[model samples]
Target: MKLKPTIFVFAIWATGLCHAYASTSHEIECPTEISAAALAINAPEGWSAYAQEGLRLRSAEPALGPPEEKAFLKPGSTKSIKGGSIDSWLELSGSGPTGKWIVCRYGERGEITLSKKLHDNTSACTVSSRREQVQVSCTW
Candidate 1:
């Protein structure tokens, strides 16, 4: 997806073109915390799993198969979402049925830490930067 550098000009243009323009790099919120914990626990035991896809779908990163077999977009999300990258670490976050998610990648170690809210109904985890099913704010 080709990202539009200017965020104010548009919110949700083409589904694939828009990623995360605003995500919390500071202290996280409740939704973010829960998701992070669940993702850590859900990690498969005795297997070294890393986020192969930075801007695409991390869940389907390991699937090196045909398009029909691969799920590039997470459930409840129409398109793949991505946050900006800092150095080698790519930060990603979104809120929907997935609640809030975060993925941090380390360059040298090839480490990718994934997190997502397992169950959330009380808090929306959104801000003023959202428009219904369109763009939801990922910032704190």
Candidate 2:
């Protein structure tokens, strides 16, 4: 079988486009003070949970607990990006300066939704709605 020149060119272009889209970066712009480690879900909640769900992730299982992966987070950057997971919600929960707690959500489609300042002891961040804005709850 012989492929036409135009067809071949389109095919190459499409392949390149696909690769770019697949590797596209989803970035979250947080203040410089936030460290990569602090911008993610911590232990006793998201950590243990993600370890448990790692199997589910490999088997295409549903999300079992708080979000673990960076999804599309920038390397060594705590921007709390999205678009890594195809269908699941992940979180970033931590206590900020002076124990100001915060939680963020990294959705299945690579969407990052950071919660308002929460209680320092909050262990997880779950999504909800309040005052027509994306509200997140810190629990456990």
Candidate 3:
């Protein structure tokens, strides 16, 4: 009976300690040489753009939690914004506490399409425009 109390106390302490170190907050800076068009594209609804040595994109949605991985093109890096294709990687960080986040890159082609597989659900997006103006919308 006495052991039960002691075990409960230890378990609570261990859980608290784990939660304390679960997530970290840091400021990400953006590169200065990014193209005007890239700069103009509004970050996803809940992301913030920062200007640091390297362009770092931070998420502002506390509910979605911190990002596991972030993706962005380096300044002066020219990617083919045509044929509805892009070469990008979804960066990940944090552990299971932070749900998975995705990076969808699309070209500035006519009605570009972007799709991602999240677990069993596949999400699709489209970017319609080729000039400096690009628009993107995603659907699950």
- By lDDT, who's the top model here? 2
Q: Which portions of model 2 show Cα errors greater than 4 Å?
A: 23-140
Worst 10 residues of 2 by lDDT: 54-63
lDDT assessment of candidate 3:
0.34
**Residue 26 miss distance in model 3 (angstroms):** 3.1
Local accuracy by lDDT, each model: 0.29, 0.35, 0.34
Candidate 1 collision pairs: 35-116, 35-117
Q: If scored against the real structure, what TM-score would every candidate get?
A: 0.20, 0.22, 0.21
Q: 68-121, model 2: which lDDT tens digit per residue?
A: 422222212222235222222333334334443333434343344342333444
Off by over 4 Å in 1: 1-26, 29-94, 107-111, 116-140
Please write out the lDDT profile of model 3 over residues 90-138, one tens digit for every residue: 2232323444323323333212222232221212323233433333333
- Ranking of all predicted structures according to TM-score, beginning with the best and ending with the worst: 2, 3, 1
**In model 2, what is the error at residue 106, expressed in angstroms?**
19
lDDT of 2 at 33: 28
The predictions' CA RMSDs to the true structure, in order, are 17.8, 18.2, 16.4
